[model samples]
Target chain A: MSNEVVLKFHKVQKKFGDFTALKDVSFEVKKGEFFALLGPNGAGKTTLINCLCGLTDRTSGEIAVLGVDPEKDPVHTKLSLGIVEQEVNFDPFFTPMEILRLRRGLFGLPADDAYLEWILEKLSLTDKKDVRARQLSGGMKRRLMIAKALAHDPPILILDEPTAGVDVDLRNSLYDFLRELRTQKQKTIVLTTHYLEEAELLADRVAIQNLGETIICDTTKNLLGKKNRTLVIETCEDEEVRVEIDNNSLDLESIVANYPHVKNLRIHEPKLEEVFLEFTKNPKS
Target chain B: MNFKRYSTLAWKECYRFLKVWTQTLISPVIIAVMYFAVFGGALGSRITEINGIPYALFIVPGLVLLQSTTNAFMNPSSSLIIMKYSGTLSDLLLPPLSALEKTLGYMTGGIVRGLLVSTLIFAVAAVFTGKIVPHDWGVFLLMLFLANGIFTLLGTILGIWAKTFDHISGFSTFVITPMGFLGAIFYSLEMLPPLAQKLSLFNPFFYLADGLRYGFLGIAEVDVKYSLIASGVIFLLLFAANFWAFRTGWRLKL
Candidate 1:
């Protein structure tokens, strides 16, 4: 991936009336990077997304999408970004094909039936292409949102809780599709999701935001590596115990010698969820 | 400034009403026909002439203006309110469209709906009165365009301001409907006493109806030149207001 920044938030602050939604938040997403922004409810994720998309104004600080400030050049900035919002906001009366055609026209892009057909097929929405959006199921609606976002073939795609309420099968397929977008298509993706496991599986780098501020930002491997290694041991007495050990001190020979009655031993690396919970649950950390 | 984007937005707005022609187009046409049947048929002979023109002929222009203006106001207001409520407005907002493009796109829908309703009214009037010709076709078309443009802008403002269905209905009920009736659609302002005629001057709709009437019948209570100027000023003001609203993202952006 190129080191060039695709998105940058420099000490951004967003205030609604007297209440601040984001407080001195700053981060940068590199080109062709699968970046995950994890936060609990009301962690300013949506507010941040809104500000990035020009749907909401920032109280202070600067944001640039592909080096273009959205505030200064919203139309041009929006042309490079595609957002799959948390809600299904499509026109109810329009069919999937009709909506895509309309979106393509809105972006001033020429019609390419092959691309449209490929997007529909990838999202498993081929059969529902002619059906009104409102008639589609919840999962289908979510996929339709993705399809609409991809319609313009924007360079950067931001998915705000794309898999919320989505079935496992569809979610897995979407994950695969997103991976392909990052790997084969070299598209930069910024995702905000409540599903930590999904983020752990997909995100190359993850940022945890809490109480409207980003507390931690690092690569997924580095973040997970911060926590100590865990060892789960099973003994002949049919007893199981989990012990936390320093990563460097985790030696299988030493562990077996220490627990002679051990029947089986397994080393466990801390999952992303553990690190996320640790960072968010303790704000001062 | 992209023609393709502007045209697409405009086409979508037009397509929305066209797709629901039964409610948007046919219903208004039916209501207009009923008005002519009741007002023009039942009372035509008794109230023979209004301002030197036959009562039936006089009301044709007024009814046409009334339907067109109401439609022009309702189209954008309801479209915006519905999109706002259904959370579908983000579709338009997320696009690379400029505020001016969005404003013109929405206004196009209202303009098209207004013209469609006006044409239907004229068609129905032709069948009944057998005379659909105008004194000055240029003035007639100009008045029609200006009148629709004014209401379409008003609807856009109300659509942005309104938060609920009741708010939109209330605007139509308390504001637009009363203004239409008081604008002298059924009778001439000259028929009223001196004081009432003076009070009628305060009504903006009066200018629209009077200007439209003068276009068709070649006679009006107000000076056509002054009415044209006033209509032009009002159109510019409404356009400016809508432009400002979109630019500031009033009630549209968070």
Candidate 2:
């Protein structure tokens, strides 16, 4: 268990005055594992990430990333981690390429021109690298954000709302780049996204949080499997309905007899979106 | 943790102000000269010398202090606000740099801008009226740095608190400008009644201006020692506040 742990939260909590943004929540990201901190808005997915990044202080408990305390050893911890914030803040005065150059200098990391070119090329930001950040479109800005986070080449990458307000092509391109990072760079990714399908596609484990508590933490299959055996039926007068039922409670014969128009009966794997909704509905862990 | 990173960031910040000199650096210097030429030159001649220095010379130090204060405060404050507004501030914050590094980076920009404007005003003042103050390079530099440091902190705090463009300007107009005018910048605190002079002692900017004037003219309405101690104390307090805000990820990152 210790060998695989990349990040561990021991009952971490955060409170803004009276409102607890994150309850006594704890979770782990295994080494090199693609993980997701999934939740709805204000559900505390970003709150947990903020605590890990030292952007927000935790009211209770401890957080260790890469064997360093996030609060006490933020510099060392930050060296091993990269975070893409939910909100965007770029230097309007500097061009995209200049920003990356400045960031590289700030980190005291030597410029690997080859890697820089490769990232810019892959993210489709090469052309606009010369243009100031303010001139770029929203999606372009998001793409440049990812590129900046990637520039340091940290072992852990945390993307918060990475694909927000992005066009489909750019989203696909970014995903392809991330998938490459996950596979080739040995980079552990903590993806906080509203798109469940993206999580299902990339995250090795998905943790759904609600009201500051983690409601579910398991592999994508195991979590999605619990809500399988959905029953979609067409009743009398061409009436149609859908239901997700437990396999134990489902009687195929009874279902078919009750609704004869449900002729195209078949079993399909559960979608991650359905399970996410159910996970969010319950607040208490 | 590494001090070199702060140096690098600070260098970058300095370069930024210099690169956009026309706006951040030059405009303020030109404005400072214009104020001296129009007000100090035209009106100061009619005015008699005070405290063994010409009226024009007497007013130059405080006016320069005024420019440095505004520039120093505005440089860092506007830097943070621009990053917040234009969505690019993340460039510096997300890295391994310590909070002190980031804080120093922004503060250094303000310091440089303030010093540059202050120097330009000094040159223009020398041409407009000989040796604006007697001479004390060491104390002059000290008071200028202290004033810049204090107002830079003020600007940074205002920037953090401000959510919109007008918010920053509003603070500058309603608070900073009023404080500058009333801090005995153009008038001697000694001219005020006993109660008014006592009240002006409470103004930190007054100490800043008085201490700076003492360096140039060797005369001040208040004790130079008291002005030095007050300005020094304000600088340290503001530095602590700025560093704390930086460490807490205050509104800078959020």
Candidate 3:
């Protein structure tokens, strides 16, 4: 939303013994941007997140959160960042409220009961606030993780595979909440999800990583614009029959106009999943 | 150091054990009572005095130290190992906490559990033996504090290094328990043969038990000064090890 950069990476590399998790990775996230990072499993998306939050030290390269290098000043850099990890990992004994309160305290933030209550309500966790985390359903635990991350009102939020196991209704609700946070609160967000549709719906800018290297970074509009379209034609003879063809072919329009059996015809735009496969299948593309 | 973050972590550690008082606090007290009843009561009449201290009183400090060290070691070790395996350790790592702050926070839990168990055993021993007063109050407190520090550090290290629950329990069962028992807790070094007495000097638990015995009953098989020095050196070394583990994020970081 703004020209100010919230995060920047310069040729960052991470190695685990002989295996390299991230190699020469460089990217920048602007302030108030809804950025989506797409990667296959073991593509080093979590590794990048870990580097930004100082959970692990990068083997080589430079990273800046806000204006501070995370490796040099991790605590200070972390003050402005919130993270919702891929796994649902809460202290089993603690309730949702207690977990949020504890997280806020860890950030040295003063108690804001009203804000906490509001977060619980927004996440649909008010009814389950008193229940222990271990007793909560998977969806509820995911919501609780989001609540905990947002408790301290961080300027930037990074969510990793947030909706991996979530149902459609809950995932839709999370999308609405995240959209609200981006548009209304103007919080910078970076999300990594296996669901390409989620990224398609919310992301302003998208980056796809493969084999520990970022293969593509561009505006969502530009990336989607490059996708191929599909033409679907429905016909009724003795029974209904469907014919599919590439929308870009010259014969597509002629076939619809000339075919007497054609009852309905539609052109479908390329989905994010198709584009994702295209980009990941051939990283150079 | 951010006091708020440190205190929050420390409080969490304390709260974890307190929340499971039956397992963390009560079980250790029960075990200490059994030790006192079996070893101190049954074996006391056979041996009247150990180095001028009553046999019951002599074994009291050793039992206290033994329980203190074991619980102290187990508390942080299990907490960390569970967090690691369960993937909850990221909860602490993601926060804006320095490595030192994290270490101190976890150490507080180990220290509290260790001291709590030791105090309970001391109270129970006082009732049984009718000896409530320590020979030297200052030395007793110092020795107790140092012993807790040593084991808590060890626990913190193992907690960071361990990848599985069995690894943590294995260390406790195979290393800590054997060292505590063989460290002259029940029998004096004089009771061992010459070679065994020399080997006993190498056991750190012996120095811990002897140091505590000196504090409680004013008698020690090893010199109190030497024991204190050994405990202090071990404490510093363990502290360094824990600090290194935290700072480097060994096994903790992805």
Candidate 4:
């Protein structure tokens, strides 16, 4: 990934009447990077996305997509990035092909049937392109949303829970598609999802937000490396015990020596899931 | 503004109504024909004449205006409300199309539907009254656009403001429908008492009906010049209001 920041949010805050949705959000995603935004329910993930996409106004702060502020230049920002909103927003009356064509025109892009067709094929929506969107299944609709986002072939892709209700198989296929987009197409991706495992598998870097504030943000490798590792000890009596220990602070040799009757012993690297739980569960820590 | 994008949005608006021709086109014509049959045929016999034009012929322009007005108001309002409720409005909101383009695109749908209904009603009215052409084609076309433009933009504004289907229907029923009826669709300003006539002058729909009536019959109770100017001003105001609504993302953006 290039060092240049493709997306940036500096002290973003949003308020709805007396209720604040985004308290203080700030982050940056580099070009060609797959950045995941993970948060619990009501953590202002969608609110932040709304502010970034110009769907809503932020009460205070700045957001820039490739140096163009969305508030000042919404058209440029909209043209630069394609967003798959958290909800299915396609018009059911329109066919996939019609919707895509309309979207292409809306973005002020030249007509390219071949490109749109390729997008359909990439999302496995080729056969369903001519059918009305309402008739499509839930997974198919989700994929169609992605296709619509890619209609303009934007440099950046921001998917807000793209696989919320999708089945495992389709979700896996979407992951592959997203990976291809990042790798082959060199598209910068900013994803917000409830599925931490999805983030773990796909995101190069992740940010965890809770109560409208970004609690932690770092590379997956760095975050996992910083977290305490787990040590599992299995005794000859078929009893097993797990202990959390920092690799640097705890002496592994001394811990292993304490288990003399151990039949099996293994050291486990902390998973992103555990790290996410820890940070969100105790953000102050 | 990109012409291609604006034209595409306009085409999409047209496509939306055309996709449901039975409700948008045919139903309005059927209702217009029914009104002509009941009001023009039955009522015309007793009324004989209005403003020196045959009663059936006098009511023809009013009938056309009435359908055009209702359809023009309903088209954009329902289109907007449905898109809002379904969350499909983001497709338009996220696009790079300018606010002016969006306003014109949506207004095009309502104007087209209104004109189509007017044409259909005029054709049907011609069969009964035997007048296919208007007295003044320029005035006819101008009134058609001004009246249609005013209501269509009103619908666009209401569509953005309305949160539910009830809000749209309620406004149509309580405000638009009552205003249209009191605007002299069935009778002339001279037919009413002096107080009612004064009240009729206050109704914007009265100017619309009178202006269109002058176009069809070359006769009107009120001066057609004032009606033309008033309708033009109203149309421009509504157009600006809609443009401002889209530009500011009023009620559309969170």
Candidate 5:
């Protein structure tokens, strides 16, 4: 609320033995921003999340969450953070409600009957609260993960693959909930997901990473707006569509001269995936 | 966070185990009683007694120590490992809980489980045999702590390093079980050859078993008082080991 950054990593580097998990990765999540870190598997997206959350130590550089360093004050700093890990960690022996209560108790929070009831209601898990975690469907288990993360009402939520492998309808529902979180609840959301469309739909900003480095980062509009700059057109003509090689490429006369049906030419626009792939094609560079 | 809340967390973990009494609570008890019935009834008749007490009585503390240590270690280590496996660890790690809070929560859970198994076995022993009195409170508590602490440390390491289900079970079978038997759980170190007797000193579990037996029977093959110092040293060492395991993140981060 105070125009302060909720989380920041300045040139953060994390290495394990000879392998670098994250290198020169730096970014800032402003207060109340719904930011997304988009990357393929093992692209150091989760590593960045762990380092910020203080689950893993950064090899070098600095990190701050809510003005407190995760290393120096892991306890205080984590107070306002919530994490939804990619894998579900529900105990087979525990019911979803008990798991929630146990998680809340770990943070030393008092038992709030009303609040607990509200959360159960919000997640539509009231009926199955008494059911063992193992019995819950996969989707239900994932929801329990979110419920656990939000148990303490942390101001920031770190969602790792929040909707991976989920059905489209459920994914859309999650999106609606997350959008509400950003707008109405004012929770700062940092999402790392493989689905680019989800990022395009919900993220206020998006950062693409490859080989432990951020290849490109900008507002979602700016990144996707690149698609508008270029257009891809399809025509029935099977001619090897080599238009021409000239500096004045957009000159209408010159463009049409090489291919008489250039008037029917389709301009190909770059998609977010194309731009992303292009950036990471030569990651070292 | 208040200790009361931490206590609640620990109780929650305890309740988790208790809820499924068949696996966590009942299985260990059945295993111990089987060991006692088979090892003690069949073989104990021939041995009669070890040192001064009845043979069954002599091994009771060792079995108690074994169940206690295993539970103490498994409850937290397994919980964490399973969390890491299922991705639940982030729930606590991402919360306001500090490393200390986490350590306390997990260990308390383990300790509760240990005590439950210990008490259950103790009750069974009381009903089955009338020899259940401690020689020294200090040594008994010390043995209780070290047996729990050492395995807790070992479990922490195993939890961190395990990548699959097989890895954890492998540690229990190859490392922990062998160590338990070697710790003189069912026999006296005096019966071993001089070389083996010398080697037995290396197993910390031996001293815990001996110390705990000494507490109950008013005498043990090893010096009851000395076990206190030994157990304390073991506790300190394992504490540091687990602290390092947690600090380094070991195989926890992927």
Candidate 6:
């Protein structure tokens, strides 16, 4: 990812009547970055995305997709961004080819049948292109939504739990597909998913939101590196305890003094899941 | 401004109804045939002719207006609420198309459906009455265009305003059907009492039906020019209202 910021949110706040959904959320995503927005349910992750897409108006603050304010020029904002919502929302009556044809027209692109066919092929939907969306299996429907989002080839793609009901094999393949898009096409990707492992495995930068606030935003390596290593000690009595290591320093004498009957010792590195829980579980920390 | 996007949405709406041809097109024609059988066949015997034209022939224009306008209204109304509830509205909303473009696109579906149904009903009317043709083709086309444009735009407004299927059905059952029945379709103003004749002046559907009848027979109870002006005004008003609803995203964007 380069220093060029392709998407940005500045203190974005959204309220539905008396309840605030997004409170003081601010972040920037650089071009070609795989950014994961990690948050608990109702933590304003989707709400923030809605604001960015101009689907819902924000109560306060600003959002810019590729240097253009979405509220000011929603047409331009939508033209530059492709969003896959959480639900399967393609028209059930239309076939995959018909849906893509309209999507291409909506983006003001020429009716390039060859390109659309290629997208269907890449997504493994070419076989099912002529079938109505309602007849497709759940996995195929999900894949069709992905194909629709990629139809226009927008520079930035935002996926909201794209692999929610996908099978394990399909999920792994989707991950590979996303990786190819990011590496080969250099498309900036923003993903929000319940599966922390997907985010950890794919994202270069992570932003954790809790209770309508962004608690932490940093690179995956930095967030995980900031966490201290653990020293797991096992006693002869089969008791086990953990000690936090600071700055990679381990005082063997102090550890031996503390655990006089130490039978085993091992060091453990924190996973992104652990780091994510630490921030969300205790936002103040 | 973007004709491609607008035409795409228009065709999408058309394809949606066409996909369910049994429900959208064929069913409405069947219902109109039933109306022609019951009203024109049974009732025309009692009232032989009204104003030199056969009773069945006189009711032809009204049935055409009814089927045409009703289908036009239902096309956008039901399609939109269904899309909204099913969450497929995002397909139209997330794109770069402008509100005006969306409005025109949906309106195209309604107008096309309206005209198609009207053509079929006219054919059925011809079979019963023999070779129906417009006495004033210009006025016939004008009345059809105006009625379709008006109701289609009204449907667009109600589609965005409606929150549920009930909202759409409620308006159709309560407001549109009543107005259509009382709109001088089945009877002329002269057949009613003097007070009722005066009251019919306020009904827009009366103007539409009367205008259509004038186009078919070159005769009308009221001044054909008045019907023309009223229908034109209603179309413009609804078009402006639809444009405003789309621009503000009134009930749609939230």
Report the lDDT tens digits of candidate 6 across residue range A1-285.
Answer: 799999999999999999999989999999999999999898999889888887789999878999999989887888889999988887888899999998998887889999899888878889899988889999998989888998888999999999999999989989998999999999999999999999989999999999999999999889888788888999999998988887457786787688888899988888888888899898877
Ten-residue region with minimum lDDT total, candidate 3 chain B: B90-99
Pull out the clashing pairs in model 2.
A89-B87, A89-B88, A89-B89, A90-B87, A90-B88, A91-B88
Query: For candidate 6, what is the DockQ-based docking class?
Result: high
Q: Write the per-residue lDDT of candidate 3 for residues A8-42, one digit (tens) a residue.
A: 98888999999999987888999999999998998
Distance from true location, Cα of A16 in model 4, Å: 1.8
Residues B1-254 of candidate 1: C-alpha lDDT, one tens digit per residue? 88888889889988988889998888888998999998999998899998678888889888998888888888889888899888988887889887788889888889999999999989999998887798889888899999999999999999999999899889889988898889898998878999988888888888888898889889888899877998999999999999899888899987
At residue B24, candidate 5 shows an lDDT of 85
lDDT by residue for model 1 (A228-280), tens: 88889999898897888887765667766767798888888899999999999
- The per-residue C-alpha lDDT of model 2 at residue B124 equals 82
For DockQ, candidate 1 versus 6, the one ahead is: 1
* DockQ by candidate, in order: 0.81, 0.47, 0.70, 0.83, 0.51, 0.80
Write the residue-wise lDDT of candidate 4 on B83-145 in tens digits: 988999898788988899999988888899899989988988999899987898899899999
Local error of candidate 1 at residue A186 (angstroms): 1.6
User: Candidate 2: where are CA atoms >4 Å away?
Assistant: A1-3, A108-114, A229-267, A281-285, B82-93, B130-134, B160-171, B187-202, B217-226, B248-254
CAPRI accuracy category, model 1:
high
Best by DockQ: 4
Could you tell me the TM-score of candidate 4? 0.97
Better of 5 and 6 by DockQ: 6
Task: Kindly report which residue pairs in candidate 4 clash with one another.
Answer: none
The C-alpha TM-scores of every prediction are: 0.97, 0.86, 0.93, 0.97, 0.82, 0.97
DockQ-sorted candidate list, best first: 4, 1, 6, 3, 5, 2
Q: Please give the TM-score that candidate 2 achieves against the real structure.
A: 0.86
Ranked by lDDT, top first: 4, 1, 6, 3, 2, 5
lDDT of 5: 0.76
